[model samples]
Target: MKNVIFAGVGGQGVILASKILMEVAMNAGYDVKESEVHGMAQRGGSVDCNVRYGEKVYSPLIPREEADFIVSLEMLEVLRKLDYLAPAGKLIVNREKVDPAPVQTGAMKYPSDIEEWVGKNVKNAVFVDTEAILKELGTRKALNIVMLGILSKDLEFTGEQWEAAIRSLVKEKFLDMNLKAFTMGREYKETA
Candidate 1:
């Protein structure tokens, strides 16, 4: 079975990214299951999705420490979901920081040592600057797709399959930009 966790704040397209992955897995003939938590998403609160696919999937929720991949669209969300990742799982994280309610309200501080912590704790992690990539792509709305592109590198899906999935899910107006973002993310080389 393949377990993937997609996490981020609201408006980051975390759900859309998971949907694209589900589409890809389903298109490849795998039985896919998914679960989502949209806690205060409209208020920029946390959002996460669990996706599992294989020859047979009986559950939508990924058990603790069993996820093969944790694709986080925000750096802090990586910390929040780190416990779900398998010991040898890969982390594909966008290097963007979105402050939570407490942090925004000055009740708590966002951890400043995320990179250092990840360096010590995560065996395999790829950190991408989705902001820079999106800036170059001329669209800020495709961060999720870019993160998906980075994740596509480790999955078994072909480029064409990914593109097809993106084409199916993304609207026509944003297709070319999102496609470019995916290519850039797939080709991104920086790692942690």
Candidate 2:
């Protein structure tokens, strides 16, 4: 894989998601490098992370037009970063929208037609309602894990390897839920 782009609004665990993938890749013995832009970033602003891994990776930066996987934690941001996605890239977007608090509070702004925009721009889009899936799993906070579940399908690691990777990253307490989420995500590819 040349590059992977993880995009979403702030507080959506985009960075954590990338970290998990990075760890998994590294655990699989691949040279991995990741870059993230997160500072005073808030709920409404755009946040993204770049992860590049292979036998040899030179830079942590992922240039526009090189991303092979566009994994979106939020639907709109998928459109926000669409231009950076490679021509034949695959998109995995959470099929729900967490409109920024600004739009909800009438204190900020929001772009229009985000979902439709993404559809028009991306030819290969896989829509997964992460929020709903997590709720089905009996919690709303598991949104990130649920989305990660979808991403598992794209990884080149084995189930055992992925579990080990998750164990290496998550706290012992969050192990069960996270593992469940990851397994669900990893299975998404086989059945998708």
Candidate 3:
């Protein structure tokens, strides 16, 4: 089974990304299961989704240390969900940081050593600059799709399947931009 966790703050399209992955897996004939938690999403609180797909998936919740992939839309979220990653799991993290309420209110500080910690702990970690990619694409709304694009490179799904999933879930008005973002993400190569 392939277990994936999509995590980020509210308004980051965490749910949409998971949905797209679910669509792709379903189209590929894998039985899929998903679970989501939306905590104060409207106020920019944490949001996460669990997606599992394979020949037969019986549960939606991924146990600790069992996820094959942890796709985090924000750097801080990666630290929050790091425990869920399998020993050999790949971590795809956006190089963007969204301050949580505590930090925003000066009640707490966002961890400054996340990158160092991730580097020391994760065997396979990919950091994507979503902000820069979205800027080049001329839109900031397709960050989720862009992250999915990075993830698409390593998954078993075909390019066509991913496009089809995006076409089906994304509205017509935003479809072109999202498609471009996805392509950019798939072709993205980290410079450092």
Which portions of model 1 show Cα errors greater than 4 Å? 39-42
TM-score of each: 0.95, 0.87, 0.95
Per-candidate RMSD, Å:
1.4, 2.5, 1.4
Return the lDDT, model 2, position 65.
84
Which is superior by lDDT, 2 or 3? Answer: 3
lDDT of 3 by residue, 1-192 (tens): 999999988888888899999999999999999998754654678888999999998889999999999999999999889889998999999989888878999999989988888888787897777778887888777898899999898899888999999999999999999899989999888643
Q: Rank the models by TM-score, top first.
A: 3, 1, 2
lDDT of each structure?
0.89, 0.77, 0.89
Poorest 10 consecutive residues by lDDT, candidate 2: 183-192
- TM-score of candidate 2 against the unseen true structure: 0.87
- For candidate 2, lDDT tens digit of each residue in 33-63? 9988767775468888999999999889888
The superposed Cα distance between candidate 2 and the true structure at residue 118, in angstroms, equals 2.9
Model 1, global lDDT = 0.89
